[model samples]
Target: MHLELAVATDLPALHSLVESAYRGDSARAGWTHEADLLGGQRTDLAALQIMLDDPAQRVLVLRDGDRLDACVALANRGNGTVYVGMVTVAPRLQARGLGRLMLSASEEQAVRLFGATRIEMTVISQRTELIAWYERRGYRLSGERRPFPADDPRFGLPRRDDLEFTVLEKPL
Candidate 1:
């Protein structure tokens, strides 16, 4: 459960881990998957590289030896809050509590690395189970709705036109 700052070396495995955790037939093994709502790739390597290159952001990973078990990205919003995204775990290893562990680590990293006082994330509104999971982790709806990037197939191809995001936040 040692969390480390992701490097360029982690891109390929990280890409696979994320896609498998959220899309395609592989994601069905995990309860947190978005397979029912979206199609295509969850994320791509180029996008991951950009996140890693951003000075105000970091992609953190937890690994077991050579295994890329989990990863989450944190971006310093410069307003005492950090944006959390791409929370991922190995699909086959989901429900084993690794998501929680990654989240806790991300929170600690947020506070320690960016001096953040708050953490925020956006989840698809259609994902009730995932939203509830975050709520149980102390996140609450901010009542703000963001339209899903329907044009951005880089993340995923939406299955429904009503897809949108709900902001979730927690105080550190």
Candidate 2:
């Protein structure tokens, strides 16, 4: 696998990969699917453009040959912390160590580019398996909670009412 910062031309592919990993029937092939709790696009091109335009943010992609297989977004918060999100892996490629590698690369890039002291992320509070995966990688619950954007179609239409985020952090 190869790792690199994603360019504008990669947005569409990245967008599709992310959506396939989180929404729709295609996502059901992977363990990370959130389609059961939400229904709609996982991400849109406009939001991706905004992220690409942010100077403090980096969208990293992991490629197998010429195909984009995984990606994650990292933003330096200017407070010695990097916020990580939108971690996506091709459904068929999930559970093959790609997610772990992509996350590690993102953290390394955060430290290299911004001298980050820690990396933080938010996961759906009810995703026990997902949270455990992060914990195995050294992340710990930070005792913080944020309401899921239920009113935002840009995120997703909540299928269930009990949706919230739990913050997770790891020292870099």
Candidate 3:
């Protein structure tokens, strides 16, 4: 696999890959599915375009030649930290080390390109296994929690009212 910065033309494939990894029945093929907790599209082209237009942000893609297999969004926070979000791996390829490799690539990019000293991300609080996986990679809970955006349809409609995100951080 090779890592590259995603351009605007990659939006459609990126949107589809992320949706398949986390939404609806298709996501059930992988352990990362969030279909039970939320409903609706994982992302849309407009939102992705906004990120692509931002100079402080980069969408890092892992590809096998022209095939986009995984991706993550990195944003330089203007501090010493970079915010990592929207991590996704093709559902069929989950748990096979691709996600880890993508995340590591994001962190490397953070330090090398942004001069970042730390990397941070928010994960759904209910995803214990996912949180543990981050823990194993040196991320620790920072005791911060933010309520899930139930009001935002773009983020998906919550089935339960209890959903929230826990901030996780790691020094680069």
Candidate 4:
């Protein structure tokens, strides 16, 4: 597989890959599926388009031949730290180390583009398995919590009322 920075022109494929990786029936094939907790699309094309157009943010794509296999979004937070999110590997490709590759590439970009040493991400607190995955990747809990936007359909329709985010950080 090859890894590279994503361009605005990649929006459509990226959107489909992301949706399939996190939501819908396709996501259920992977351990990372949020289908049980959220019922709608995790993201939309407009939001992705904005991220692509933002000079301070970058979205990286990993491809296996012509197939888009994984992606992540890194945003410069302007404080020597980068915020990482929207990490998604093709559902069928999960647990095969592609996610790790995309993550490592994001961190390298953080260091190279912004001279950042710290990278932060927020995971839904209820996602124990996902949190553990990040822990194994060198991230530690920050003891910070943010209320998950209940009414934000852009994120997804929450399955439970208690959904919230737990912040995690890693130093590169």
Candidate 5:
């Protein structure tokens, strides 16, 4: 399998893929989606473009020819750390181990691209299954709780008000 950095032309597909993996009925086909917990867009094209433009950030995509299969975003937090987010796999491709492959690749890229020794991410506090998944991958909860951006439409429209984030970290 090959993983490559997403380009400008990939933004639209990235947006659609992320939405399919995180919202609407299409997302329900996947085990890793937030369809029941949220509504609205997962992310906007502008935000994606900004990541593409940033020297310290990258969105890696795994593709089957011209079709996107999976993606993960990483940001160099500096000081030997990188932040991982936006882990996504096509709904049809879920439960087939693609998410794990993508995540492993992301960790490799984090170290390769940024010389990172640690990687971190935030998951919704209510996603127990997801947190367990990460734990199996060696990430531990850092006990840091962050308020979800409930007021930010750029992220999503929360269906509930109790949403919050718990930070998870691992040494690469």
Candidate 6:
């Protein structure tokens, strides 16, 4: 397996992978599924395309031969920190440590490219298990909360009105 920085040309596969890993029935094959909490698609192709085209953002993709096994997006926060998001590993390949590999690669990229000392991400407050997974990987809750965008269909159709995010941070 090898990891590569994704380009705009990878938007389609990345979109499909992100959706399959987080939403819909295919997501159920993995422990990370949010299908029960969100009804709509997790992301759209256009938004991903925009992200790919952004000069300040990079989508790191992990490939197992010809397939994309995992991926994550890293954005420069302009404060010596990198914001990581859209982390996904192929549902069928979950629990095989691909997520950890992608995360470690992202951290390395952040430090090497931006001289960042910290990497941060936001997780849905209700995703206790997911948060615990991150904690096990050395991230900690930063006591910061952000209101989940209720009106943003691009995120997902929240099953409850109380959805919010808790910031998690880890030093590189």
lDDT of model 5 at position 157:
89
RMSD of 3: 0.8
Superposed Cα deviation of residue 22, candidate 6 (Å): 0.4
Estimate, for each residue in 76-154, the C-alpha lDDT of model 5 and write its tens digit: 9999999999999999999899989989999999999999999999999999999999999999999999999999987
Give the top-scoring candidate (lDDT).
Answer: 5
| Tens-digit per-residue lDDT, 42-88, candidate 3 | 78999899999998899999888878999999999978999999889
Segments in model 3 whose C-alpha atoms lie over 4 Å from true places:
none
Question: Candidate 2 regions off by >4 Å?
Answer: none
lDDT of 3: 0.91
Write down the worst ten-residue block by lDDT for model 4. Answer: 1-10
TM-score (C-alpha, index-matched) for candidate 3: 0.97
Name the TM-score of candidate 2: 0.98
Steric overlap count per candidate: 0, 0, 0, 0, 0, 0
What is the Cα-based TM-score of model 1?
0.98
Return whichever of 4 and 5 wins on lDDT.
5
Query: Candidate 1 at 138: error in angstroms?
Result: 0.5
Pairs of colliding residues, candidate 6? none
Q: lDDT per model, in order? A: 0.93, 0.93, 0.91, 0.92, 0.94, 0.91
Against the true structure, what is each candidate's TM-score? 0.98, 0.98, 0.97, 0.97, 0.98, 0.97
- Which ten-residue region of model 2 has the weakest summed lDDT? 58-67
Q: Which window of ten consecutive residues has the lowest lDDT sum in model 6?
A: 47-56
* 31: Cα error in model 4, Å: 0.7
**What local lDDT score does residue 97 receive in model 1, on the 0 to 100 scale?**
91
Tens digits of per-residue lDDT for model 2, 1-172:
7788888999889898999999999999999989999999788999998899999998999888878999999998988999999989999989999899889898899999889999999999989999999999999999999999999999998899999999999998
Tens-digit lDDT string for candidate 4 (35-136): 999989889999999999998999999977777889999999988999999999998889999888888899999999888989999999999999999999
